[model samples]
Every structure is written in C-alpha cells, then in structure tokens.
Target: MHVEEVFVKARFFRALVVAVSALASSAGFAGEVQVAVAANFTAPVQAIAADFEKDTGNKVVASFGATGQFYAQIKNGAPFEVFLAADDSTPAKLETEGMTVRGSRFTYATGALALWSAKDGYVDSNGDVLKKNEFTHLAIANPKTAPYGLAATQALDKLGLAQAVAPKIVEGQNISQAQQFIATGNAELGFVALSQIYKNGKITSGSAWIVPASLHEPIKQDAVILNKGKDNPVAKQFIDYLKGPKAAAVIKSYGYQL
Candidate 1:
C-alpha cells in the first residue's frame, strides 16, 4: 500500500477504537440494579423505576414479595442490590447485621391500610362491615412476614373483632396476595394497602373504608442499599432517587405519605 493510504487507515482505526471504548463505558455505567421491593409498594415502585430508567438510562430489576421473605433471601446472598421493605425494622436489622451499607436506610413512604370489598356496598367509610360480621371471609397478609398483615391484625384488635373474626380470616403470603383474595372473590372482604385499592387520592374500584391511621402503628416503608451494592453507583443512584421529588410524587399519588 502507498504510504499516504497506510497513514489514513491507521488514523481511522484509532478513531474507531476510541468510539467503541466510549460506548462500552456508557453501557457499563448504565447497567441494571437488582432491587427487592415489598409487594404493597409494587405499583409505585414500578412507576418510579420506569421514570428512573427514562431519565438516567439505568435499568432496575425489581422483585416484589413480602419484606420478610426478601430479608431471608438477602441473608442467603440473593444478589439483590437494594431492598425496599414494608416496615422500618427489617431494614434496620439488616443494617445492624452488616447486611446493608451503613447509614443507607431511610423511610421511603408511609403506607395506609383500607378495608376493601369487591362487592358493591359491602364496605362502608367507617369500616362498620367488620362490626356487622356478615362477610363469609376476610383476607389479610400473614402477620408473621408482612407489615401490612401486622397492621391489619392491629386494626382488627383495635376494633375488638380479632377473636370474633378469627375463623373467617384467611391469610395471604403477602399484601398483594391478600388483595388478590378480595379481588378474585376468594374472600368477601379484606384489609389491604390503601395504595392497592386507591390511586390519585381516590378508590378507583370496589367499596372501601380507608382504615384510620390511628388504628395501627405507622407502616413506615424503608429502603436500603444492600451490602452487595455498596460499591455500585447505579444502586446508590437508585436509593437517592427514591428520596427525590419524582419518586415521592408517585408514592403520594398511590395513597402513601412520603
């Protein structure tokens, strides 16, 4: 080849190599963050994840389940970069146990409970349906593993119906499942996250009584960066994103308090 042609080819090859390297770097920083989210926060988290992806070019892979289950999975090294728990205690425990990045836990949202029935007119604003004791079954999350479930139990006890309604109570593995029981007619009525039955500050479907927050302790949903994600920039970004205005707006719209 002519000397001039050889020089031109060398310059072009170097440019091509630099371009490829730049693209690879971008792809590396835009990698996915694995997140474990409590079932009750599923809808709001999904919305936040979508917006985060669009804005930052980073991806989020979320697993929705009971917070206790996620805690177990994380202890077993489940590769989750972050955990969004339905209660504050779980994340604090993880932090104390060195399972999460130190000082990384924070309350992301405060969830509300509601007494809901798929059948129209079955539930009232005051939750008198529980006192009437007419429903064949009531669904609630398993109090052992789900914060919402614990809250449901508290509310029932506060209403003086815990013992009276024991036989008719059906337990779901998670809040999502409890909601499903009510949705699919497996249970005539149930206590669920207000977020599950409400959107835009209103109940979208079904009859519901917004459970008074006074009925139980605050369901302070917490988020933390797991130990495996301490060094992950994207995971840190995601945790920060959860505390930002964008995510807070979505959480509020879903009937949660930021």
Candidate 2:
C-alpha cells in the first residue's frame, strides 16, 4: 500500500518485461525454414524436423530429392535456404562458388549402402546375392548424379559382378526412385541407402545386405546454410538444431551414422 512498495513493484514488472523480450529475441522469432534435403535423408530429416519444430517453434519446410539435382536447382536460383547434401563434395563446391555461408558447412552423416529386395530374405547376408546374378532386374540410381548410385556401382565392382549384372540393371534418376523400382516389383532388387528401408536399429522391410565401408569411397553427407539462408535466423537455428543430440538420435534411428 506504500509509495515505495508501488515503485518497487513497477520496477520489478519493467525488468521482467525487458528480460522476457531479450529471451524471445535470443530464442529467435518463429519462421519457416526452407531446406533442400537429400533423398537418402528423407526419413531422418523428417523426424528431426518434427523435433526441431517442437523444440524451437520454427517450421521446417523440406524438399527431398537427389543432391545433384538440388545442386542444379540452387545454381538456377532456387528458394532453398539450406542444403543437406548426400555428399560432402557438393556442399564444398557450393562454398567455393560462394553459394553458402562461410564456415557453415559440416559433415552431418557418413552414409552407408545397402543391397535390398522387396522380397523377404531375398538378399542374403554378406551380399552374395549380387554374385548369384539370378535376379531379372536390378535397380540403381544414376551413378553420375546420385552418390549412392556411385557407391552401388563400386560395390558391384568390388563384388566382381558388374559385367554380369550390367544386362539386368535398371536405373532411377535418384535413390528414392531406385527404391521405388524394387518396392513396386519393377525390379527384382536394388541398391539403396540403408536409411531408406531401415529404422530403429533394424531393416524396416524385406531384406538387405549393408555393404561394407571398404567397398567404395566413403559417402560423407554435409549440410550448409545457403546464400538465401545466411541472413535468416531460422535457417541457422535449424542447422544448429540438427547438430544437437535430438537430431543425432533421430538420424541414428534411421540407420545413419553421425
């Protein structure tokens, strides 16, 4: 009831308001972040994005496709604010061309390859199914454009089945399509990213042979803030969220190694 009490209460309220405003600014205003995601990362990124939205109050707008196609789109001035590439080289190329924020690039995952079939138990352990060469059709992404496709080819070569399997190969424009080929039975089997059909520490469907790391060049996937996203706080925030434990866990759940 005293003047001093009233003044103290008013000062407390003003200080509380200032603190709240500062906290909101630091937390960042809620905004939609547009990200171009690699096809192999579709499931993982979707899970991570959901957690990111819940944690940061920012919406993630993700477009999933082949990395090379997305790179071409970026060069042609796509509206994507962030790029999650299937290979490190593409992001590095963008950085060289000044398409990304300086020092914003980092490897987010080391991709693993899998030999899979829509048929249960069709792909034997250790990937000897490729050597059998009995399948009517085998699906693979375009090696020139999809890094996973390149890895698939290398795996076949290492298994010494490239020449024999050449006649049976059917190609997809990207990994997702390659997977679809097998899923729809258009191809008997296919090589796909392990993440595509794996989750929760197991294969989600059919059967798969996880290609050994020594079969081909390591697939180092990277993420970077694109030029359009450099000034967007939500973009940076999303990337930061991806680097956190929550994102890492989701990525791991999808069979990707962080």
Using TM-score as the measure, the top candidate is 1
lDDT of 1 by residue, 121-228 (tens): 889878888999988999999999999999999999998999999999999999999999999999999999999988897898999998899999999998999989
Question: What ranges in model 1 sit over 4 Å off?
Answer: 1-28
Residue pairs of candidate 1 with colliding backbone atoms? none
Steric clashes per prediction: 0, 0
Quote the RMSD, in angstroms, for model 2. Answer: 5.8
lDDT of 1 at 21: 100
lDDT of 2 at 106: 94
The prediction achieving the highest lDDT against the true structure is 1
Q: Tell me how many residue pairs clash in candidate 2.
A: 0
Residue-by-residue lDDT tens digits, candidate 2, 54-149: 877889999988899999999999999999999999999999999999989999999999999999999999788888788899999999889999
Tell me the spans in candidate 2 whose CA falls farther than 4 Å from its real position. Answer: 1-29
